[model samples]
Target chain A: MEIISFMIAPLAATLILGGILVYFGIHVIKREIVFIDIALAQIAALGGTLAIVLWPETINGGGHEEGHHLIEYLFSLLFTTLAAGLFSLLKSKKIRIPLEALIGISYAVATTAMVIILDKGAGSDVHIHDMLTGAILWVGWDKVLRLAGMVLIVALFHWVFRKNMMNLTDNYDNSSYKSKRKNWWDFLFYFTFGLVIVEAVQVGGILTVFAFLIIPASTTLLFFSTWRARILAGLLLTVILTIPALWVSWTWDLPASPVLILFLGIILIISGLVYQIKKKVT
Target chain B: MNTLLFLGPPIVISVLLSIILGYFGNHILSRGIIFIDIAVAQVAALGTMIGLLVGFGEESLGLEMTSYFFTIVVIGIFALTKFADQKVPQEAYIGIIYCLGLGLALLLAERISGGSNFISKTITGNILWTTWKDVWISLLLFSLIGAIHVFFQKRFQSISLNKSENSSINRTRLYDMLFYMTFGIVIVKAVPIGGIFLIFILLIAPAVSVTLFTNNWRKRLIGSWIIGSTGSVTGILLSYSLNISNGPAIVCLLGSLAVILTLWVILRKRTVSV
Candidate 1:
């Protein structure tokens, strides 16, 4: 019972974060921009690293300072917003380079820039280490509640703009449907995506967040054809995977995020195999 | 004088990377598998981490062979999975492989003490501390790879440029495996010295920049080499003058150049339209 109680917050955190990430994952898969999440996450990390460099006291002393956290959050938000804008702008028809190439370029640059900044900053070793490995096992209720609130707002925003957003993604290749307003909608999609990524990355690190975003969605995609079925199934898959992963991690005293990611990867592979077998038999 | 002595090896190493990776970068961009280098590099790093778990020394030949073995397995998987009928795109598989490799590496890193240092090392390598011997090895290996590519330039280009539709599937698959094997070997060599991010930039940025100007194969390759070498030289000089890490300095310089050139091309289009 005590262990169960300890697992509650993380379970809730994964469910909340996982639900939204799966939805975004559907869009990401549809748009053929599967790698953008990592790119944006790296850009947000760069923002946080820059904050640390400019205001050493923000993260130098090791104690949690509310103002410092806010500064870091705002910096990340600013950078992600700019990236969202840049991404939307680059999607114009005139640009001949593949968007994937640009995304890869951005990811590499943002990551290297963070390394450069951290090399000059104080207490970089700790920050770099922390940036890579998430501390999901130790998350508290307060953080979970905060993330829930943010997820709720973003969820509502997506709900309100569902039709336009879905149309934009569904009709992405239709030249007639593409418009100036579509650019605004694209920016909004990427902006909200960046928002969710920044928060989820801080909680679950890059790999787990990526696992949540892509693995379940891709797995569900193999079995379902409709958005409704896929989203519900993806969320269900997350819930199913999260409980056992968390339980195993707690039992073995292993790191929760990577364990969860491994579980997700395993499930994805199993489903992929099943998918292949079914395809061959049919 | 003192700075030159200290910085010479990394500079030479960067030039060597430019000469080789710039060529591979062209193939990568043309093939449209832009993230494959990073994915393969991450998998190779996982191999090394597994070697560490198995008690191999850091620079041991056993670890190097382990890394090569892992990369070959992954390259084979990539070659086999290039089916045209799969619902999921190849990019999705690339992303999944990248995440899985990284996740497993992190899991293993947790078991080993001082593992975070190793993880960070794979991301941002210790290029400043590179030695003359390392430079020489890179030079020799790069020359060998370059010669092979030069010899079979047409076969490789036919595949990369997607002009091999008449070839048998098995034959094409053979070429695909060959391509990724060489690409994988180059990546495994560069990752420890330049790190994954630097290798990614080196593999993509120069190709993107040069392709913006020309379409001729020879011209594109030469343009990429010139652009790559110049960017590396300037980036190293910038790192020396500004007192920053060597890998990131070069990455930022080349990355910025690619972005700027892209913007220039865009603006030029606008002016022409106006």
Candidate 2:
């Protein structure tokens, strides 16, 4: 049963995450800002790192101190929400510096600040290293359930209003260029985007989230033109990648993040080769 | 007096590195080849990890001699990223190469460490953990970087900046190869100080900070060096005293300085209007 639960843990996380990505990741790719997800994840990491670095201060009368649980989620949510909100608000069309640069800066500041902060404190600690890497062995039933609930809620909302979300990302200029209500729809995408980064960070750090956000979505956009196929492809790819990653990490004693990343890399390379072959043959 | 000496080396190194990287990086950034910086830094870092694993393992010399030797390997691999005129944007190639390089490094490190322990340092980079020996090594690296950058400074400017002059000039494919060689070296040397996380800022930020003030590439380079120099002096102290990460503090300082100057420019604009 313990082994079964352990196996199910990765399966559940992958399915839930893959389903959500299948629905939304395609559009994120279409926007040509796949790096934005990584940026948002880094921002979330920044927030979480800040909170973790400061949590000790709260105990010593620093009001900015946060609970361990809150530290993990709150800061990331704050940054992601604020950033996503701003991106939606501006309806940014072709920012000169890809949003990834902003995210990279966020990581630079957060990771360094975290080191300084952590160095000063001595205590009962959670090494955030594993969380960021998504060592599948680290995922438990609780994490799986929480992420599942979040994904379910997101997927449901996506179902009822898929048209609005698609319109906002696929043709933002058309939407905001002519209609105002569409701006509100963009808000929903940003909200979902922010929420995914926050929740994913608490569960699997940024790398896994970044890889799925870009690779699967881009892969779909490459082969499939319609929104529905792209979403299905993304969902399938995320699962296909995640399962093997978890198994390989366990069997080979490798880190899950790299395993997951390698799986994505393999998929990307294979897909690229196939795409090339098809182009040649046709 | 204490602070000046404390900050002197890193500040100098960062400024020098910034100027050298500026000529290559700015071109890449403008062309939207951002991930290339990350990809290159990561490949070099994996080389460093191999150096660390071998250096610390009974014999240290093997590590030092071999770590940078891997740059040749990365350059050879990265050269293929252009993929014989395949239309994939340079940034896409960068992302692919960076992920592949990092995956290779992570696999190697885990095999040696037997766990994912060193990964924290691998991904984020730990500067406070830097040794004086590394500082000395960085100084030598910067000197070498400085000599090369200044030597061909005009050529870089002419090729990347002066497009109209391209037809008239005869710098040749050798010039392109020289730039890539320097680009690989900058990434290799910048790894320890800037790590994968902050090199992009050091590469692009000071340059970005400088471009706001001047149109001339020389002036832009000088302005960026000044910003880097000032940030280096201040950031190291801030990192030491306030217990902050020096890299981000440097970046924040860079960003803050940019904001102040930007504010001044807006103020000047208003004054002129009135």
Candidate 3:
């Protein structure tokens, strides 16, 4: 009972984020840029690391101090949006390099640069690890409220731009070179997506951000034929699995973030296997 | 003068490694598996992490075996996993493997003492602290791999770059093994000494830069070597004068060069079209 009350804060935040991630996952799966979240998250983390380097007072392993969270948040926002801009610009037809290659390169560069910065600033690897898998157990009401507000803003934006959002992940090779407006839509999508990722990463850590973004949609795609059904399935799966994941963490006193990721991976694999079996049977 | 004397050997070693790696980088880009080096290197790190957990020091034979063991596992999986469905890009699988290796490494890192520092070191390797032994071992291993590439250069290129020409089944399979094995060897050695970032920069940046101007393998190889060597030498000199870490300094130099070359190619193509 004590554990449940303690976990209630993170659990609520997880459910809300999970609901939002279902929408993001639709775009991510259709686009087939599965690692974009990982890339964006790394870029965001680099921003936070830069903040740490610049203002040493904002450092903490479990969580950042409240008053200075804005400093890190602003940096994270700036870095990810810049990355998104570069990525969108790289979409020009004349640039023969594949977007996937650029994304992979961006991930490598952002991560290494973070390490280099952290190393010079007398930061420890634990900070990087924490950044990768955050201390979700330490989440307070204020952090959850902040995350909820970010999700609401993104959700409202997605609602307002439903048509563009629908086409955001359509077959890129066809529509990628069609119009400047289309490119603008892509940039806007990435920019807004980056904002959510920066918050999601801070709240849940990198692995959870990726899992929520990829696993839910990926698992649903295995069973559902349409985007609507897939999103519904993803939402259902998140609600179902996140509870057990939190419970497992509570019961074992293990870190909830990795445990949650482990559950997501297991559920994804199981869904994939079941889908394969169903395909074989039919 | 003393700085010159101290930095010369490592810089020269970096140049030689860069030339060979630049060659491999072109092949890797051609193969469309740009992230394989980092993937294989992470597996090696995972192996090294496990070795440490089990009480084997970094330099111990046990750790060496574990590192090689993990590298071979990844290389085997990557070489053999051929999907019948062509819809899924190979990059997806490479991304998956990389995430798995890194996630497991982070999880393991939590248990090891000073694991974060160790992991960071693995990524941005400390080249300034390298010994002559590190240089010689890299030279020997790279030479062996380079020999395989030189001898079977045509067969390897046909299997990797010109996939349609690889109709001879047995020969194709043989060279495929040779390619992955040699790649595995280079990454295993390069990661520990050059750090993952520097090695990745050396492997991809140079090769990718040359792709902007030419597709001819010979010209690309030579062009990449010149860029990589010059960048490394300059980076080393800067690191010495500025008292910064050699690995990041070199990575920044090479990374900037790659960006510049890519931009130049793009602009030149636009001008030609205009």
Candidate 4:
């Protein structure tokens, strides 16, 4: 009962973030840019590192000064949103560079920059380790409420721009100036996406954020066909995975993020194996 | 001036790694397995980490053996992954393998103190600290792999570039395994010396940069080697001057060059059409 009570806020937040991530995962899978979450999350991390560096006494210091957390959050959001815009622009048909490689490059650079910054003693007094893996097991109700608010705003945006989102993911219609206008919509999509991911990354860490963004949707793709079915299956799996993962983490005293990611992998592999066997038999 | 002397051997090693990686990178690109280098490097790092858990030091023979052992396992699995439906994107499998490898490493790292640092270390390792002995070993291993590749260059090229050739599924799998065998060897050896970031950049950046200029494989190989050498030298000098880590500096520099060349290609094509 104690453990469950403690886990309530974190669990709720993880589920909400997982659902949002799975929503983005659908577009990511369709666009075949699966690793964008990792890249953007790392960029967000870079922003956090920069914030901590610039305001040593404010963010992540012993005392959480008023508005410091917001500044850090905005810094992260700013970097991620800009990266999202750049990624959208790079989707220009004329550029022959594979977007995945570009994303991978950015991820590498961001991670490198992070290590260098951290090495500079910017996070000397703080346990900046959680910036990447995150402290999910330690999230509070206030954080969850804030995430819920962001989730609602993003959900409303998706509902309103549902048609544009679908077309951007599926159509690949990079023909003319009209497509360029559509690109701005895509930028808006990624910008809002960056906003969503920034909060999730703060709560769940990059690993969990990536797992939620990728595994559920990818696994659902193996099982389902339609968008509605995929999202439903993904959310169902996220819930199913989350409850036991939290239980296991609480019981065994393991880190929740890696445990959750490993479970997702196990589910993906099992589903993949089953799908392969079925294909082979039939 | 003293920094130049001390950095000379490592620079040579980096240049050699860049050339060797650039050579094999064409095949990786042609196969569209863009992330295989990192994937393989991660698996190999897991091997090394396992070695550490078993109480072997980083430079221990035991660590090297275990690293090679895990590399072999990952290579075999990656090769067998091809047996799946071709319609199903291979990237899914690769992505899953990468995440699993990383997640498992993190999990294992829990048992060992400061285990998580190994993950970042594998990505951007300390290239400037590599020893002369390791450099020679890398050169020899690369040579052996290069010999095999050179001997079977045509067969490998056909299998990599023209996938839908006259070959049965079994035969194709065999060739891929062979390619991965050599690839595994290169990655396992190079990773310890150059780190994953430097190796990945050398592997893809030069090969990719070459493609912006021409499609001919021979030309691309030569062009890649040249770009790789110059970029590596430039990156090393910058790292030395700026006092940053050698591996990541090279990766960032090369990454910048690849982006520039890509943009130039795009702009030129746009102007041409206009």
Provide the TM-score of chain B versus the true chain B for each model in turn: 0.96, 0.76, 0.93, 0.94
Model with the higher lDDT, candidate 2 or 3: 3
Taking chain A of model 3 alone, its TM-score versus the true chain A equals 0.90
Of the two candidates 3 and 4, the one with more favorable lDDT, higher being better, is 4
Question: What is each model's TM-score for chain A?
Answer: 0.93, 0.80, 0.90, 0.89
Candidate 4 colliding pairs: none
lDDT of 1 by residue, B1-274 (tens): 9988988998889888988998999888887778898889889999988988998998899999998999999989987899644687778888889888988887888888887777777877767878999999988888888888888788889988877378788888887788889889999999888888888888899888888877787898888888888888888888878888878888888898888788778778878999
By the TM-score metric, which is better: model 1 or model 4?
1
Provide the lDDT at A66 for model 4: 65
What is the RMSD, in Å, between candidate 3 and the native fold over all Cα?
Answer: 3.5
Best by DockQ: 1
Ranking by DockQ: 1, 4, 3, 2
Decoy 2 TM-score against native: 0.80
**Residue-wise lDDT of candidate 3 within A235-277, one digit each (tens)?**
8888898888888877777777767777777786686568768
| Poorly placed runs, candidate 4 (over 4 Å) | A51-64, A117-129, A173-180, B54-58, B271-274
lDDT of each: 0.85, 0.63, 0.76, 0.79
DockQ of candidate 2, scored on C-alphas against the true complex (2 decimals):
0.29
Worst 10 residues of 2 chain A by lDDT: A90-99
Model 2: CAPRI class: acceptable
| Residues A149-210 of candidate 1: C-alpha lDDT, one tens digit per residue | 88889899999989988889888656677556887899999999998888887788777888
Q: DockQ (Cα-based) per candidate?
A: 0.68, 0.29, 0.33, 0.44
TM-score list, all predictions: 0.95, 0.80, 0.88, 0.92
All candidates in order of lDDT, best leading: 1, 4, 3, 2
